[model samples]
Target: MDATIEDPRLSTSVEVVFAKQHMPDLRGQVTLRAMAVSVVLGIVFCFVGMRIQLTTGLVPALNMPASVLCFFLLKSLVRLLQKGGFAVLPFTRQENMFLLTCVITCLNLAITGGFATALTGMTSTVAKTLADDPDPRDIVDNVPTGKWILFFFLIGMAGVLSNVPFNQVMIIDYKLLFPTGTVVGQLVNSFHTPEGAYVAKMQVMTIFKAFFGSFSWSIFQWFYTSGNGCGFQSFPSFGLGLYKRRFYFDFSATYIGLGMICPHIVNFGLLFGAIVSWGFLYPFLESKRGQWYETDSPSSLSGLNGYKVFISVALIVTDGLINFITLVTSAAINFYQIRQERDSSELTNYINKLHPSLNYDDRKRIEVFLANRIPVSGPVAGYIACAAISTVAIPAMFSQIKFYHVAMLYMAIPVVGFCNTYATGLTDWSVTPTYAKFVIFVLAAWIGRPGAVVASLLASGITMASLHVSSQAMQDLKSGYMTLTLPRAMVTGQLFGVALSSVVGPCIFLAFQNSTKPGAPVGSKQSNYPCPYAALYRAIGIIGMGGVKELPKYCIELCVISVCVTVAIDTAVLISQKRGWSIHSYIPSMTVIALPFFTGPFFAIDMCVGALLLLLWRRMEAGSAQLLSSSVAAGMICGEGLFTLPSVLLNMFKVLPPMCMKFLPGGQEVEVVDSFLNNSGASRA
Candidate 1:
């Protein structure tokens, strides 16, 4: 086993806590203290995930950061105990992987459990403003934290349980490379070694420095905020004229950090989308306001609001429907090929064929992994129970969703789960949002108007949560396979994470919900917590129920034109891929392009700035840029996100800033103040 590693992705050597591969056993590895630490880390990530979900609706891969932090803290605790003359077991790679599994699962629920998206999409705050004649029964007054926690827990549990049977097929037989999972395994294994620990210490310190800087900056920005739209967040970085068009920077460290973490294509896509919709389409639509619709209310559905909501909806739904069909077809063909390949050979022989391709350390890892087999009956029974309960209880909780609807959704879960998971395995992207969009339109059309809004939103939540958890479980399974962690332990850690996040996710979401006027009249650039996708999701439900009738004049035609354009773009990319052309990567994604239309173009500028910084860093020193960019970016993101809850609390307590800084078109501050005072006096008189 003392041979050099063949694959560039695999580590050079293997190390474990005990001399033997499985000496400590699964029970000893998952101790009480490890779980306690996992919960603490889970809360921190919950805060970060909630911030991303509400602001940009773009969450980067967090497995690497989470694993790094886990190792740093645990190692520090062990050394401190040793210094105090207390005997403690050394931290192991297995323990770190277990903690990572728990933390990541919780973080996923916080982001994708639909608190900021579909759930808020069904609320009265978003619905009434967007739709002309929204149904009273379809719009929920509020979803309390307690009830939301229970709802998330039920759906989350079902998602976790449904993916257990596919482990052998995806991991052992198909031998798919979940790149994120592999990176996480390599990180965990490397950190436990003496050489790897030294490198981790440097990364941890770098992260802390970046985190402190970001946190301090946010605190500084808070002191100058005297009133509505009176802080650095509203700075007109790109001249006042463009700022009026919602194209100025918001001075957000979180967004800058997110830009660094997100791929370059995503950043460029947001910019391109912003320029297309806000810069051109919206302006033209506004010019035709009086002739096309009316000049009565500024927020009228037959005016700019219709153009903003329905046009974006048309692009999103068209993109989602096309991708859904393509992915399903691809999955069907792949499954058929696999079945045919297996017909002439035994499954074990197929699994053994993967052995020669791997290095010595990976071979050892595989050996240790297959020894601790997970039971099928446990997960089977668990899924059946959760499915049965959810089928009955979900409809009871939300009246719009009937027992038949829940039954139909549950039947479709396995197929959607497999397709999503398979696609995730190949490319490190989760298309749950696309699947959720398709579900929203289908269920809305099935149930018809009035009640369709509530039913579609609720059903999408259930579908998204389940598919997200299933794909994530498969990824973690691959990580476990590489790190030699017990499959049973990995499953248990996932469940524990679901339990913790069931409470944490809801509580954080409620804090944001109550703290800010989410889904209110405040536009995406003006509001601190705009929850952009919620508005988009609600608009989709409305469109699904009303069709072209709900749209303004010329809007439906524009929608059709946008659909055809998107189809042409996707077709071009596919053809380019088959012809060995490298041009497909340059093209922006359809789903990402639709995002900035709803959220406004301000953040796109911030993200591009971040990508520019990364480019500059790479130009200076490539190695340091690759290693420390994510760590520094994550620190900045977490630092600002950590302050979000506290900032909300400060707002709730009626704390006010001492000074107000105003920026006007002509720099006539005194005139503005005098005009404000005169208006106030006239109102009183």
Candidate 2:
């Protein structure tokens, strides 16, 4: 008997490997209830995902939790309807997974389009600050609202269109192991068995408990504590503070969850980077550049922090370039090997080989079923139509960009999508920003124009959005593959999601914009949202367009040195791996190396704590460590993440009275002193 023909009843356990052989009837996989549930949840999560990104600079992949949530909700709804003697088929596993994927994909689209646009405006603010003649007005004032809207719309469309080809390449041909997708696949399959259902229920309950617990804690921490002395911070002295800063922990559940999911090497890498920047280099820089370092103002801290971010960017870029080389070389070798196998193998020569037992009609039916099982061209037409619309509409909508530039963007979509997909496959970090920067850099170098900054922003926005969508799409396809879901159903669900998010995301962003004081600078007191990612992207855009001249000389030097050190370390790891050294397995990831610096020491500290705790747990009880990590850690993440949306809404509506406690009066005093000094400096100038 073929291994693929195993009966489900005989199979005692559910596993992702089973998906390869377990082909189910695809006709009823996508039901009306599933689509309706998906649409409603997709819209809800779009707002939730956008709010989460805007608030915390993190977007929790909600597919797993949402899947469990949908299962329970739908089951309850069915039971209620059945009480009235109405016949309704319980949702199949495929329908449930499809619904969750739609919701998660839509949520991601919201974050990609809405959040990217918000970041663009925020980046413009940073650009003005860097200008010789700084402007006090909001950076978004210069760009027309219609142009911004149209730009976001095009980006969303591009992401949806490009995702199809990228998904086929990454999920089908390359067979990248999307870890999150695999986990989700396993989770959805668990609903089939009684024991699995019980486990799933527990997981759902754990998430709810953790979510409300964390949510309540967040409210108390923010409202009652006045947002002071909640997290550990460094001592104020320059000498001690440098070392102490690395120990700063925010006590966030989000970071703890991140640590639980991420590899130990990643956690160590983050800690190592934090130590290098805050413990050693920052102090050294302070001594060497006293005038630049000695400042009490919050803005000055941000300025000094830019050096650390620059170092991170340098390391990230260097690591990315090396990875790109390795990917290209490996791909060439793989292609050659595949070609050789195809030429030599008898199976490859036989195109229409069917079982001898099957009759002609049976063979034809099987062929048609297999062809429909995996969609090749139905989605292609939709993708092409979307691409065509974007190519034509973008230049017309945004006059700053020319037809040729838009054409160039269209040309680069496949390249960027492939690179990002491959990179994410390897590191689970989409170097979208880095690739965007490279795109902008090449374009700026070629154009050599004054509007280079604007061009860079626009190009980066489009590239990032497409890459974001492609990455998510590939991940979704992986989940579908693992769950034995129909490829066409997954594609259809994504299209519906993209369409919904395209509208929901922009509306949410526009609401925020309208609420902001008309003339107030973005990231100021009057503006409610602080966009950290936007700041990072803005810095990249400026550097891409204007080169090192846009940054301080010292920053340039730091960036160069950082890149050199990163390359050396990576090379050592590569050599060690080639020699099959066991110790080499622990080499840090570039994504982790740059995370602490970008997110701040506080975030790193929490993650480190979680990683260490998990390490200890594994040592104590190896068998249960996996279970504890997945359930408890995931609950913590969902709890904190879901709670933030309501928290933001409450704050937005002023449901809670303002509360302040001066736990650190000296910090306030220092702020006043900094304000006075800044005023004096301005007057003198």
Candidate 3:
């Protein structure tokens, strides 16, 4: 009997390999219980991801964390129900993958939506950063929660549907290695094996322990944050002088865990950026404050801060453009090659021959994968309907844009979606933000100010949400291919997940807006939520309208120099890679290096600490480090993130902490103590 053939009288070895599994279907996968689990976990991941996006301007990948938690929770549920004598559906790998897909879909939608960057850029919070007298008109009225929810759904669904046609091209035909998706696929499969299950159990235990400790630490830290510049968050571990430059280890579990997850180059790039901008560049620019600009105010765009914002923008925009061009060229070449190759060879046979390492079960998995196919027409029809609806509805929602603008945008989605997905598969990097920058500039220039900022942001939201969702969908599809799960099930899960997220993301953003002072003045020693990217996006919008010539003295010159430097570095790195030089990986990414210019160096310090700890652990015990690293990091990140909701509620209820603890110089400390004693004596008298 052929091992790949389905038969009732198969051999024992074949049976063992199949595990008596029927044709992979969505029966147990998309059950009510699965959706319930997905939604719950999805909400948690979304909250954490959104919080990170708003604060640090970076949202770490949550797919593995979601997978880990889903497996643990579902496995526990099945066991508990069985022990209680209740009839419970046995947990399966398909269900786990389904849940992971849903949770990750929801998470990506929440964090990648323009809420943290483009949308926030139009608010008064970010407006105050661009100019001392920002336009009241630029402070567009906030979209109502219900309206925002609808907007997200319309765009998000459109985005997800837009890429379904390419699943075959990216996942099957071309065989692009979506790194994260591959990791997730392998992870899902491993969790079903005996040894893998044991390791997963250990991972779950480590995660919970880290979660508890991190959550407790957050609670403890909250007690000392009664006043500004108080608590461990403000601790100047690098001493007061360097701390003033935003270089300090604040012991943040979230950032530290993120550091553990991120590559060393990312952490080093951040620290390098901070040192360059805050420690050296900013100080140098400030020394010429009297000579360069009239006012020394950090908040004014014409002052020292202008150099920071525009210079960072120059680096970001230049880097984005260079990478965008590079990716598009690569994708185009690959597409050409694929077309040429398809002319001479059968795709399935080619695929089979491509992976000689794949054993019989793996081959069988591929057979099961290709059996069920989603028709191309279905996605095309869906995409057209969405595009037509979005064209009409988006213009109605935002008066700055016309129906034709969106119609024009939709025409480009197919080409952009393909490129974005292709690039993502090749590099595991999404250039959606780069796409958004392009849209922002083009639309803002077209609309012209009074309404250009709002128009730019709204246009950016559409482009970004669409491209981001599409790439994520393709990534998930790759995972689906590997797991032998139905593509239709993946789409259904994503649809539900995104629908839930549309409402959840807006509500959370609204909650943060209502509960915290995100609109407070900039340049404070500390802020509840600085939303640095929001301000930077606003700067981009303003620059898009006014042109670079309006920037303060030497700002454009500095920007040009920064762009040239970034280009030179990128060129050097490319050359090194082509030459197969060992030093290429050690080179810091230009994008990561530019991030700290907006957010400051505080989180960078925390991340470096995490990376350092991971390095030492790896040196000590490579096996345990590899085993517990991600799980422990996930636990710590979730613990701190889960506490954010309660903290927000506490702030809302005026439940203030009782004490403020801060370190000061000896003379300042004595003065503060004397003042307190004097005030107390006065009260007693």
Candidate 4:
């Protein structure tokens, strides 16, 4: 390929020649069998994904890589059967990409549903904690089921619709790099060549082997370990008359995979927060405050919790402002450039200028292609209608909220969508939670104490879900653009996915909730699942609604300090970026900054281990590290995720005995021989 090309004609010619040489056999592209397989796998993966999130508080990406692997494995089986006197068809690359897109969309929805479940579950947990005489019934009764279902569907559809135009603008026109999506596109394109297919197949096999290894280990650890399903836990005493502080990592494959994908700076920042909160602040507070540290739990506060709350709030606010400003700045620069081009007739002259080697007809074809790719009127109208319906229906469904409140939320959707789209485009991190919290806070303040709680919760849920859906949709759109797939087909596949996931996700959440023990807080040992993210959001909602009066004095003080620190750090980074400093890339993202504050210190440690392993691997084997990392990391993730489904079921049904064995000095063992009693308690409670 040429390193430099200035003429549009030459660029078009190059792409045409390349396509002719590399295009895959398209016999099976976009067929009914492909759609069916995609839908089935999508539904199954979405259910499993939700289950994983609810149980472990980790969401797995079930997209191009995973889906492609699944497709080829199935294809291989079909080929084997055909050789054994049975006819079977092979899948095309385009069909695989389409199927992958569908699965990705569904996975996104499943995650959204899981988050919603966590949100509502945590709200109940919080309410119980706050109430003098807690009743789980009161909390459950208050949730309007019909209203929720309607709201979910409307918001989900609206999210899909609202993403289309932004997808076109950001992905097609501006060509923003959706990194993961780009990788998926490349993988799909590579399937055209035999070498690429062999590499992909090897990766698939590696992932399967890793999956089985991790899965088997999980069963042993969950059933046989002294901790009874818990990860490696340790309490190291500093011997300063302070109580031993708890520290442990959840040795799960999913988190390790996440570490592989995330930047080292992010993992380091998470570890940094954990060290500051648990290692330094917790110990220091124990010394000063004495018994207060001992009494405090993960959800409740000691001085450390107070500091975390304040710091998290500060980061959220600061990150939101910076994201908004960045979006506006980018827009302004683009507008200015476009204006200059139009004013100088540069754009038109450039368009009219043809390559000396090209004829007028070739130039006209290029012009027509560009014109055809622009957003059509039909899709624009459809999106507008969906948005309008959602805006009106949501407020009407819930009588507690005023119409104007919903109207304001509806108005903010487009703004939030654009900001989130741009933010993801620039940083590959969706700061939707920050934007959601900002919206919730504003709405809560406007609604006052009487309606503040409901307003904030509803606002946060809608904003978070919509933003998440739109961001993922745009990423898929980027993939579609790269693979030269029809936008309409991609949209239709996504809509099918959305429709199915909207129903499947909620059902899985409700079933999980019903099956689990009632009256237990989310993270408690007795509880069936832990939803750290939901708990974080719930805490934010409570603060937003109740205002500063609800916060402890220490928290307020720390919030002030956090503001100063966040501003200083952001300013320094901004200056560094302006000066073209490479170090700016190492700066921790808002997600990393906020993660340690909510989740346990162990998760940070687990992710750090994965990141460090990758770093070491890269150092030792620079050339092959890229391929090795993708296969191994993905295998580790998928292995744990796919296995969690059966493990959950086994635990639920009491098929596995609750027996614990200790190897450590202080560790003790518990053997529950009565299977009936164990199963009965879970069923009844």
The top-ranked prediction according to TM-score is: 3
**Alpha-carbon runs more than 4 Å astray in model 1:** 1-22, 295-299, 353-359, 517-526, 667-685
TM-score of each: 0.93, 0.79, 0.94, 0.81
The whole-model lDDT of each prediction reads: 0.80, 0.61, 0.81, 0.61
Give the candidate number with the greatest lDDT: 3
The lDDT of model 3 is 0.81
Worst 10 residues of 2 by lDDT: 228-237
**lDDT of predicted model 1:** 0.80
lDDT of 2 by residue, 63-99 (tens): 6667777776666666777897988776567777677
How does candidate 4 fare on TM-score? 0.81
Q: Which ten residues in a row have the lowest lDDT in candidate 3?
A: 517-526
Give me the displacement of residue 143 in model 4, in angstroms: 5.5
Candidate 2, residue 263: how far the Cα is off, in Å: 2.6
Residue-level lDDT of model 4, residues 152-197, one tens digit each, is 6766776777777666557633446778777776777676467777
Output the better candidate (1/4) by lDDT.
1
